[model samples]
Target: MKIKIPTHEDYQSHDGLHYYQLWNSIGDEWLCPACGRSKFQIMKWTQRFPNTPHSFMGWVAALHKHHDHSIGFFEPGQTRFPETLICGQCNSTDGVVKRMLNLPSNFSFSPQEMRTFIQATPHGKHKINYDQALEIFNLRATNKNGIPKVY
Candidate 1:
């Protein structure tokens, strides 16, 4: 069977994603667009989850329907859909990074936008790490307004 590469349209979720469709569209091999990590990699990483009795289940549970939080919050179990699938870690890190960099709350890096920020090195695939985000912040900070703490 020919693999049908999913368009951006396919990933937009309003109600929620169908896991079966994800298995079919991207298969077992697709990487998370935000950090370029694969599901298996995320699963292995989740094995060492420091907190929670359901640690082993973290892998499946980590697959989050990451959406625009600026859109407003939904009540628990209220079927908040996705902009795309990102591991729980990346989704949380987005918050951390925004705070660290003082980016606007609504500001977010889209998958393709995020791709530009990641650094590819010979040391295998890594997340769009904090260092990368820091570098970007430094460049923009120096060029635009100049950070107070930074020279």
Candidate 2:
């Protein structure tokens, strides 16, 4: 079955500082259970905010490895037990919700799917500095039954 991944545009964009604040709010560290990697990255875009100079228009938080990336998908307003965890490396799938219980261990998003879901947003569309829009992806410090934890 296909999973719904959040596009950059799906991120909250109330203000230019919103994405950065969101990223920081998520926490400051993340770890990949399969590879024990701790490096994560975030991307954000800026656009005019009605009368205001500019605000964050898009954002994405992803786990970064040497040759691949992954993102977490959880229920809206729910932080524990992600619906699915898609890992680009090894194309592995970890079912985090009951509906995904039947997903194959090897199920993974394709290159095109990654583009459409994770990397389709264009950059440099506004005047925010790259540093201002980007940040380190953070994971929370709690443990769910199946979801990975950030430390």
TM-scores of the candidates are 0.46, 0.19
lDDT string, candidate 1, 1-151, tens digits: 2323323333332112234444445545767776676644443212433576755522231455577653432233432334987655566666777887777675455454455665432113334566667665444335335643322
Listed per candidate, the RMSD to the true structure in angstroms reads: 11.1, 16.5
> lDDT per residue, candidate 2, 83-144, as tens digits?
33222231222222112333222233333232222322122111212221111111222245
Model 2 clash pairs?
Answer: 15-56, 16-55, 16-56
* Candidate 1 residue spans exceeding 4 A from truth: 1-26, 46-61, 69-82, 119-151
What lDDT does model 2 reach?
0.30
Clash number for each model: 0, 3
Name the weakest run of 10 consecutive residues (lDDT summed) in model 2.
132-141
All candidates' lDDT scores? 0.50, 0.30
Candidate 1 clash pair list: none
RMSD of 2: 16.5
